[model samples]
Target: MACLLAVAAGYWVLGRGTPRPTGTWAMGALLGSFAVAFASYAPLVADGLEAIVPHVARLLSNCASLAAATSVLAISFQLNLDPVEARRRIRLRLALFAASAIGMTLLFAYEYMTHRSEQVFALYLLLFVSYLGFAVVDFLLQAVRQSRTTRRSSVRLGLRMAALGCVFALVYVAYKLTHVVSAGLNLHLVPEHSQCTSLVAVPCVFSVTCPALAVLLICLGLTLPAVVYPLSQARRRRWEVASFDALGPLWRDLSNAVPEIVLSPVDSDRGSSADADFMLQRRVIEISDGILALTPYRCRTVQRTAQSLTAADTEEAAAAVEATVVKAALAASKAGQFADEVAPPSAEAASRKDLRGETEWLLLVAAAYARVGDTGQLETVGA
Candidate 1:
């Protein structure tokens, strides 16, 4: 659970902006959860010094729980209520959690003085569990209601996971409440020989497993949306950047072959979509112009040979054929073999409806150009 919380904290801190102060509250909850995990487990280490001061450990655990509850309440209020009402309720919840913490501390100290009496410990447990119940229930309700209000799939899914986590937390609270009430009031509310009292079977589930599952689910809820949105944008940006770069060799070769086709200067900064799109658009235009300039050098026989060599009608095969024709055309132009009666070589540009489609088509051609452009195969095939 501590590991999960720590990872969630990193996501909230490093990932693109999270929703306002909820991120702050989430950080607090993560920290408090870490502290609680430490307090609970640190003494179990056989040689640990914390075991010598067990009362201090209990105090730390109590304080950690208080912090976690208060932060969760703050998150719940903001997610479920209007801004003004959220602020008002935040104050109220803070006071409630603080009072509960103080009561638990006093009871803990009293129980320590009484040599850890079961009754006094029961009172402490009851106080903590009551407020914890309230906090978890509120968080559950808020997450469910807020999930319904959002249309974003990520946010809705995250909130539902959080609400499910709260269900586990409520189970822990209810079990603790029952145990404490029976201990403090000397009443047998739970049936005798119940599985809950089984030292081997159910105690670990009620105590450790439930809380751990709840913490895991809540951590996922806190980080999922933060991760999903940025990841999607990054995926798209990476593909566009790769495609833009892939057109480099073809664009450079064409510009060199037809210097007059060059237009405005290229921008060195293509870190953003606007810059990349503009550069891509310019490159497309220049390549088109270069193709037009070489039209007179195009050979109908070379186009037919290139098509026969690449028989498939797939886009890749078409791109290979186009690349072959371009290479042969460039060679003819350089060798002063221009023929005005080639009748456009019978090869036409692939039909595209938009800039993105044009770019994709060109990407296929550019990739094939690197394979067949300077391989001397164009000469053998077009000879």
Candidate 2:
């Protein structure tokens, strides 16, 4: 999960083209810092390595909290302010965090040198927990407010999820604050129990559960907006590809009969990486143009004859009549038999005003053309 968060952070921080006042970079820093800091919390020292690991973990704990506080401030101001004002605000936040971080480190070192004195330890914990609490609460409020007003559905959902994660983080903060108060003031709020049973205690349980849930929810939220658009585009592209292929047979027959109608020639490899929408629209126009070019050879007697043969009012029946007429016209043009000029009406009817409607009607016509074996039967009627 930590690795996942780190990866998400990298994707957002590095994958973008330009910086916007969206706090995206700060959010990435927050995720990356949080993951690294949390993963370092567990001491990995062997007997001889004790001098290093514990010290590094303690250092990271304080520094991570400081970084998170700075990140929260950066994010909040960036969203609401102009770049110059936001930069000014972030600079002040960084200065404050830096000062407090130095103080916290000094206090920790003193406490450690004093044989881990309870008084100094309590003071250190108090300072650390207070800053962490402030950061978490600020982030929670920002997330809630933005989630409500953000228009993009994926972004809104992500903000809401992140806000919920911040709620769990607040729980974790409260638990640590309770520990600090109990230890420093000699308050006996937390019961003394064995380590195993203590794990079931309210504070202990929250301390374990809240951070894990927070990380999971926050990571998922941060990544959703990044992934949704590409996935949706891929889905749309697939449908366009299928529709383009479905028009294949009809396109081939018409283009073969009137090759001049094709403005830009398409190849078998047209589907490799070209824009699907553009390709589909081009094919629709070419098919329409092919029908117009064949009008000189369209016999009125053939259209009437084809209509009589398939006179049902259903969409498929209508398509069949049109397909039969196209087949007969193509044959007449090939045989050097030109009919008297009569303005073609089928071209206008087939090409609807809207692209979507045109594509649907043309798909039906293509299907009918594929189903009919030959124009031999329809040609006899025209002759």
Candidate 3:
């Protein structure tokens, strides 16, 4: 119980950044698992609680397992590249899981109520093994197929965790099968009755160990998100950094040239329309790049600027462009824009049509330059 609680807490902490839907479902499943396990062992803690608690615990465990399985399917759907394709796949998988779980539940209930024999228990064990085995095989095949086609680290990590979870399920099934088969053989190998059999088992072995194994499997399944989530976040951060770094030099040159071109008003400037266009393009790129490069720390600002830029038209656009650039520059310099909030950027500027794309590229470079205090390069360009 202590280990289970610890694992659940860890999951909650690690899952803080996950989408609300996924995190909520996963946490609910974890709590359900814990409730079931706690109820199962309530008998040990208090004899009076055993009769009612054990039965309730069994039912809850089954329900929790089903819920967890469904949640996993939902997460898989959410992670799919194409929503339509993902929905189709998830629907099929969920249907299959529901069918299997229902069948297994009916089989176990019937066997428990009718025969109440060790054979009935053995059959239940077999059902568990068969169901989980099928699930494992299907998931493994899907993982392999996804690995071949997608470069997404999250997808790969999710698949690997799913595989590991299936393996744990397999182990639990195997352990249950061994105990069921041993009991049916009438071999009193468990030593209390001392009957002869091929297996030399000690007394209370299954009674003492099987529940622990089940708990272990539950814990393993509950803790996987903690392992996979951090890696996914780190990978995403690194990708953003790399993308921004790629646009550094271009942004430096453009920022430096902008003041010169705008302030000097020379005949050369008329001929430099192409240069102006290029600089405008670079500005758009920079904003886009910055949007992508900046972490969650600047998300709201970036989003606001992006929305403003997208909505403005040509004449009004230049003001929006300048404002966004200034805001981004200030942000890069660790001087936040909140203190000097300007009117939103216009979407009508020469670069506003595709401003989102351009700004993203520029932002990355600006952020890098801002970090290193390399605006001197811009002066050199102006000179």
lDDT (Cα, tens digit) per residue for candidate 1, span 293-375: 88887777766777778746777777777777777778888888985556253233547768778788888778777888463
How does model 3 fare in lDDT?
0.47
Q: Each prediction's TM-score against the native?
A: 0.58, 0.63, 0.45
* Cα deviation of 62, candidate 2, in Å: 4.0
For residue 313, give model 1's deviation from the true position in Å: 22
CA lDDT of each candidate? 0.72, 0.72, 0.47
Model 1 Cα RMSD, 1 decimal? 7.7
Q: Which pairs clash inside model 1?
A: none
Off by over 4 Å in 3: 1-49, 53-59, 81-115, 147-149, 183-383
Ranked by TM-score from best down, the candidates are: 2, 1, 3
For residues 1-383, write the lDDT of model 2, one tens digit per residue: 45666786787688775854288889888777776666664435222234653454666655875685577568667876789999997887777777778778888788768776667767877877777787778778878888888888887898788788888888888877887887688785565432424545665677656866776676567557767968877877887778788888888888888898777756662553348888888888888888888888877776676677764656766666677667777788788888775435564354578876888888877877766557524422211
Name model 2 segments beyond 4 Å from true.
Answer: 1-28, 45-59, 66-86, 113-123, 145-154, 191-201, 227-233, 250-263, 284-383
Better of 2 and 3 by TM-score: 2
Which candidate should be chosen as best, given TM-score against the real structure?
Answer: 2
